[model samples]
Target: MSFRSAVMAEKEESTVEMEETNTNSRAEDEELADGKEDGLEQEEVECANLEEGGGDGDEDEDDDDDDEDQIDNESKKKTDQDKGKKCVPGIVYLGHIPPRLRPKNLRIMLGAYGEIGRIFLQPEDHSVTRKKRKAGNNGKNFIEGWVEFRDKRVAKRVAASLHNTPMTNRKRSQFISDLWSLKYLHRFQWCHLSERLAYEQTVYHQRMRTEISQAKRETNFYLASVEKSQTLDRLRKKKQKKGEAVQDKSWDFTQRRTEDEMRLEKMKKKGLSKKNLQKAQEKSKAIQEKAQSNVSLLAKIFSSGRSKD
Candidate 1:
């Protein structure tokens, strides 16, 4: 009985210790789960705060962009106003452009004096260009040019100072020996040159159209004449084949007397009446008949004398 009681007590003590250990382990698991939930919640809050901060930062960036745009617009307006106050551009005419001297080189040389606006270089004639191309000369040649300067006084000064002077002082320059033939055009604008060029092109086109029209008319007239002649020839050939006489439809009109001959005739008839002019013509005819009859009778007499001999 004593042995059985002791075994029962040991079994009881082991079961209680196991139960206490399971309870402690269960509590620790619950506490860890609670801590994990709280950490997840805190993480969510931090993410929300970060997202809100990012949105605010984006708004701030947008605001900065808007401010910059406004500042840029104000600066552009100020620049425009300043530009409106600037002087009108001046034009300079180049009578002759040296070979190998281009607009870029010209600008580089003249840019030291003042600001350049627009540049136009007149190309050589089409015929000259064709000849050059045929000769394998690919270099472009400018006959004349016009340059716009920002200031009128600067343009005038540049023109005056550069005219009759060497293009450049450098010894190795290609245009070193060439002189500038610049002339500042007073009251001239780029629009004027464009208008002039437009007018010239219009006139050239008009002239070419006129010439072409005239040539076409001449060709049409020549073709018509040739066709008429060919038709006449065919008609003549058909008439000949039919053994018919080709009738001459041409008329011989009486020739009119000149003014001098008419005047002489009028003078001769001035004092003569109709009856008198008729009697004079009759007398001249009778004298011509008598002279002819006398010559015939003398001829007959001479023939008779020759026979008697």
Candidate 2:
């Protein structure tokens, strides 16, 4: 090959390699710029995370205030009760669980730290569309309640010991899945319920707050008794309207029918009327008289029988 041709080929090869080098250098510059931008984005994200964490810390501070208040009230209640005074301790209300906390499970888990005395679970009964069925639906029936160890100090210990442990269980929903449900009751003191009756009475305490409205809060028996009284009033009104009432509301017999009519009316609607109530009164009177007569008779018979023997 000629020397001039070899020189030309060499120049062409060098130029092509220079172009490739330039292209690769440009690509590397772009990659470095991209990495810097990604780092800036990540830094911004980290800053935002810090801000969020700061806000959560504020919320935690607010929660601490509520807990402090609860503990104060419970302490005061115990003091009053210890004085042997008619200690009607004011109840402290705990707001909804922060995230995942079952009051019952938390109470039990916290119980390890203190003695739980009496736990009362009262699910509110919300009014339903069906007047009767609605009347039957109690919220307390849904939200459970419990009494923990009688020792309040232990309860506080459990609260401190179990502090941040995840207390979630299968029953907990996904929304609160991350937060622990088992925590201590801040001001809950332990009290033991003796006998079934006492336990039932204790149910009035530690009820759920479903019907938050003040007017709707009521006990089962209180509401049931009110319903019964209402029914009786309606029945009385019905009898009055029909002119078949046995006695006047004021019990003024002189203004109504004779005693014979009252007896006949009672017979006609024996089941509907309070026949047993009246019959029971009369039966009790008769029984007392008979018992007195029997006592006298027995005494006489004893004397005579002994004489005869």
Candidate 3:
């Protein structure tokens, strides 16, 4: 009985030791799960703080950029205002403008760049004679002009940009094919154009004088031609009269006549001879008078025309 009781007690002690080790293992597992949950909460808090700080920094950078842009715009405006206050009047000349290009269109074009002041264009010539036109003597038809701008700097800029460049129109259908053929006169001044125009006027008057003198010279030659043709007609008529006289003489010789008839014939011939001499003298006087009148008429016409000119 004693030996059995001792064996039973040893078995009870071994079971108690196993239960204590299991309880200790359960406590360690609970502690590890609690630590993991606390670590997750701390990480979420740090992430939220970092996001708030990043948003503030981004807003600050955007504001700085906008401030810089505004400053630049203000500086540009100031410079443009200064340029307007100090600019002077300026002029430019064009050498070869197209016949169809009008002043209004040019004004509209140039006004886009700057303000305009004055414009001048060469007038078209309308003095071509019908004979020359019929003989296909068509001359060159081009125009030249000058334009004054409101500001000298603007004028210089426009001249530099448009010089040696072809002009094109996009909005108007009529000018679609009419590219402007113009040459900007970079070296000429407005005063030079005025001087050249005055010179041209004087030259034009001199040309008119030369034309008047030439017309006077041709007048006498034209009259001489008319007189020469008139003389030829007179000679022809005289030859016909002589031939008729010869025919009459032949008839007179063939016919027989008495002495009384012959004496009567002689008397008639003397009377006809005196009449012919008088007619000849009158005709010569009339020719002299006509010649003298023509000279006076030509002189009067030329002198009157020159005086009017």
Candidate 4:
């Protein structure tokens, strides 16, 4: 009976010890699960923060693109405004352009004064050009010119200062001794000059056409007169060859009475009165009767003789 009681106490002690060990192992497993859950939550928070930062960078790039577009639009507007602006130009007339002075040289010389816009140099006359070319002088010459200036005030000032002055100070220059004859023309535009040139060209062409027509008409008339003269000559030669008497019919116009004879006749009429005129008529009648008696006696004698024979 003592041995069985001792065995029961040992079994009870061993079972209590096993129950405490199982409780400790369960507590350790719960701690491990909590630690793993905390690590997962930290990783998720970091990923969300990185996504928000990336979204902010994309928004900053969009803002930069919008700013660049606005800048471009403003610049385009400024360029358009500049293009819409207009400027009024002025003109200067040159009375005489010297020899060997070309438009290029003129521009180079005058560009020092102000901004030059348009330049026109009238060429020398064609006849003069031909003569010079024949003489072995082939250099181009300008008769007159017109220059455009950006500003009216500058044009006026240049014209005033340069008139009657030497063209240049350089002694070796070809135009050193030449004088400037400049005049500022008010209210003159380039269009007016163009119109004038066009009109002159049209007039020149019209005159040329008229001259050619007149020359052709004169030539035709001359040819016709020559042909008529030749035909008359040929007819005269044929008549002579055929032994025909070519009677030339000439018309003689009566001569007009002289003023002196008319005056003398008028004087005689005025001097004779009505009485003298009747006396003259009676004497003329007596003379006519005597002449008729004589003629009748002669006819009687001639008839008697013929009868006796």
lDDT (10s digit) by residue, model 2, range 2-67: 999999999999999999999999999999999999999999999999887998888899999999
Question: How accurate locally is residue 17 in candidate 4, as Cα lDDT from 0 to 100?
Answer: 94
Model 1 lDDT per residue over 71-91, tens place: 999999999999987877899
Model 4 lDDT, full chain set: 0.90
**Candidate 2 wrong stretches, greater than 4 Å:** 1-115, 128-147, 161-165, 169-309
Segments of candidate 4 deviating more than 4 angstroms: 1-86, 247-309
Cα RMSD (Å) per model?
20.8, 30.8, 23.8, 23.8
lDDT of each: 0.91, 0.60, 0.77, 0.90
Residue 96, candidate 1: alpha-carbon lDDT:
82
TM-score (C-alpha, index-matched) for candidate 3: 0.40
Candidate 4 deviation (Cα RMSD): 23.8
What order do candidates take by TM-score, descending?
A: 1, 4, 3, 2
Candidate 3 clashing pairs, residues 3+ apart or interchain = none
TM-score of 1: 0.56
Summarize candidate 3's per-residue lDDT along 124-219 as a digit string, tens digits: 555644455677965434367888887777888888887665566465645554444344455556778789999999999999999999999899
Q: Write the per-residue lDDT of candidate 4 for residues 1-309, one digit (tens) a residue.
A: 899989998999999999999999999999999999999999999889878799887899999999999999999999998876545688999998889888899999999999999999999888999999999999888999999999888899999999999999998998888899999999999999999999999999999999999999999999999999999888889999998878776999999897555755665778977676566666666777877778778989999999999
Which candidate model has the greater TM-score, 1 or 4?
Answer: 1
